[model samples]
Target: MTTPVEPPVPPADTAPPRPGRKLGPIADGVGSVHRAWLEPLRHTYLTSGLTLSDLSIRVPLAKSKISELLRGCGLYPRWEIMHSLSIQLQLPSWPLHRLWRQAAFEAQKSSEWVERSGDKAAVTTSLVPPLDHRAFRETVESDYSLYAQVFLDDDQRDTAVSNAFDILWLRWNEALASPDIRRFAWEALRATVMARTPHIDGRPEFGAAAFDTVALQHLTTETERMDQMAESLHLFKAMSWLPDRQLDVMVMRRLYGTSPEAVSDLLGLSLATVRSDERHANHFLQSVICPTPETEGKTA
Candidate 1:
């Protein structure tokens, strides 16, 4: 006779919400490290499709520790915490070790949390604050999986893609990993940062989020300008697929919004060459984007 495996479930009333309380040694370790400690943990339990109770039963760490970490505990992840977490996650020990080491390194580097305020966020703060615990877990795994796809070893990217869940993540992986793709991750991330700036701490306030009338209208106008700029980047990414001269024109115009004369001068091309390139780009976009039922069009 054998015992049937039980389904995982969230614990009821985990450890009375230990917020504002002083923590122990392991908790202290977690506090001193990167916010990404949960990245590995998320991959472990959340990605593996297990719940808190399931893991606590396997690992020695209390369910509360896991819950607290996910729910915004101030501690960074510890090796023992990771070991127990990986065991509960049922990952191979070797891969789990890599993840553990990577978590420690990444947490130390902590680039993602360099928000506009540039405040060194303690483990108590999140980089993207809009994310809830569940949402945050999904974002970390998804974003890092994209990073893995872009920068990871071939075997790593393939494995990550096989495990990834959505189009956003899929595109991100493709954007980051493919050498032919030209590192759009930095551009997109830069745009995201630019978009965030006006609404952020250092920039002049413009909107009702600032709770001002004319300020809000100015905010609206600035926001719309940013949206157009952001939308234009997607168009430029597509144009990069065209011939190099054409790509240059489109990038100068759309990506940076530079003038044709400016682009020609920069590339040492004649004005005619730049104009011709622009015309070629427009023709390609029209043929592909404005295709009719009678005509076949390629996806950008």
Candidate 2:
């Protein structure tokens, strides 16, 4: 009798076919999935004890393509390719699917921007930059001193500064990698400060007083200074009530000392829009703080 033939067994680590999981709609933004992919993919590949070449053979994809997936270089693979790899690597479908979606979105966004700007270099690379905490701390700490003068108590200032730095450090690498350096830096610190200050949620009040103090230092008349201070305080308080977009523009202009042109660029708005928002915010504040005769009569 002929020897019975045994069936070929799949590799021991090969993921068995499981019930297919449905993927959720892809999230917007470039790093949405890329950040999620980095750790899980690395850990799974390492645990499988497979080399790059071996993985290519098993997945039946080119080595370069495998490297792209592994590195999350912002190049998305098709759903079929992702499905095949999901089975081969035994990774959770959601992670791979999400990665594919983010990469695809980023690729499309980059393509459109490149067409508009005609500048290939404007497209951001996936390479993460090294963070220099010492440098960042040195630069921000002095600014934080001015910050402390307004909101933070003497004892709480250092602690708040440390905490703010800790929170911002999380996004430091990402900020360094982005093309919009000024806006990224401004936003990172703004977010950190907002998170720490619960009382004035979106108002940039802490530094506003400092800017006002400097600009108003030359006023010799105590009466004039007092009037200005009152007006400033009223405007500052009114900031908490302003619409979100108008508040952003007003704070960037009056508090942060950013020019209207810079505000326009930072906010991705036209100069006219920035100025108009500033005017609207100022008018609203005036209506509340220094009401006209008609508004007073109406209130009466």
Candidate 3:
């Protein structure tokens, strides 16, 4: 019989077990817009050759949870997970955060939920607020508060503004490095406020607070008040239908009396653009609220 039979050698293609499974395609449930950022993340993972196990070790998530995130499975993962993953993947967190925020909204997560999750995540990783951030807050806080108050109660306004500031604080390094910090901060504030602002037919609903404006507070007679209220409602409805840039311009210039130059700087728009938007917005409103006889004839 036999010389001892040599143990069979494994095939050359048989390799050692990988550290973890490779990422698969994003789930079909993930929207195309979401895929915009998720694709980059998947590419980063693939190129880095970091396995699911690697992400679990780097981020605090479990291996299964990390896998679900990369594949866009299950509920939208928290901002904490996204933020940590961004850090590990060496992706710039600021742009990722913006996309993640949008995804969170699409996922039906409330603004309060987003704010709370972000606050909890930030607490663990937060550093001292940079001096420039503090200075920036001081410059914009009052106006931001007033703007938010248009859509929220005093307490809610304070919370919204504070949450915006917190977001800016977390991303201040990126903000400072950007070409225009004012515009960056303004966007953060706007996003925070708009997330909380109620919508009707996919438009920001300002009619609820129409009665609260200073313009309406001085009317003494019931008839004058009712007429003004009707006009105010019409005006606010018209404003709601304005394109976002025009609405922003009208709100700042007409409601807050901000100068056009200031609106340009805050919105990261050119002065000419801001002025044009305001003019277009006014024309749209006048057409809606007080159509000229010639326009009325055309409609007739």
The best candidate by lDDT is 3
Candidate 1 global lDDT: 0.42
Off by over 4 Å in 3: 1-53, 60-64, 70-127, 293-300
For each candidate, what TM-score against the reference? 0.28, 0.42, 0.65
Instruction: Write the number of the candidate with greater lDDT, choosing between 1 and 3.
Output: 3
Model 2, 167-249: lDDT tens digits are 33434444455444334554544443444454655454443463355446778888878877877776677776777568778
lDDT of each: 0.42, 0.54, 0.73
* Collision pairs in model 1: 30-75, 30-76, 31-75, 31-76, 150-176, 150-177, 206-215, 207-216, 208-211
The backbone clash count of each candidate, in order, is 9, 0, 0
lDDT of 1 by residue, 1-300 (tens): 111122243353223332233323223344211322343344334445466666678866676777776544545445565555545654333433333344455456353432211232122122221223235234334433333332234464444333332222223333333332222333332222222223233331222111211222444477775665454444433443576456546645643456776555444455676788888788777666566655453552
Q: Ten consecutive residues with minimal summed lDDT in candidate 1?
A: 204-213
Which candidate achieves the best TM-score against the true structure? 3
Model 3 gets an lDDT of 0.73
Candidates, ranked, TM-score: 3, 2, 1
Q: Which residue pairs show collisions in model 3?
A: none
- Model 3 clashing-pair count: 0
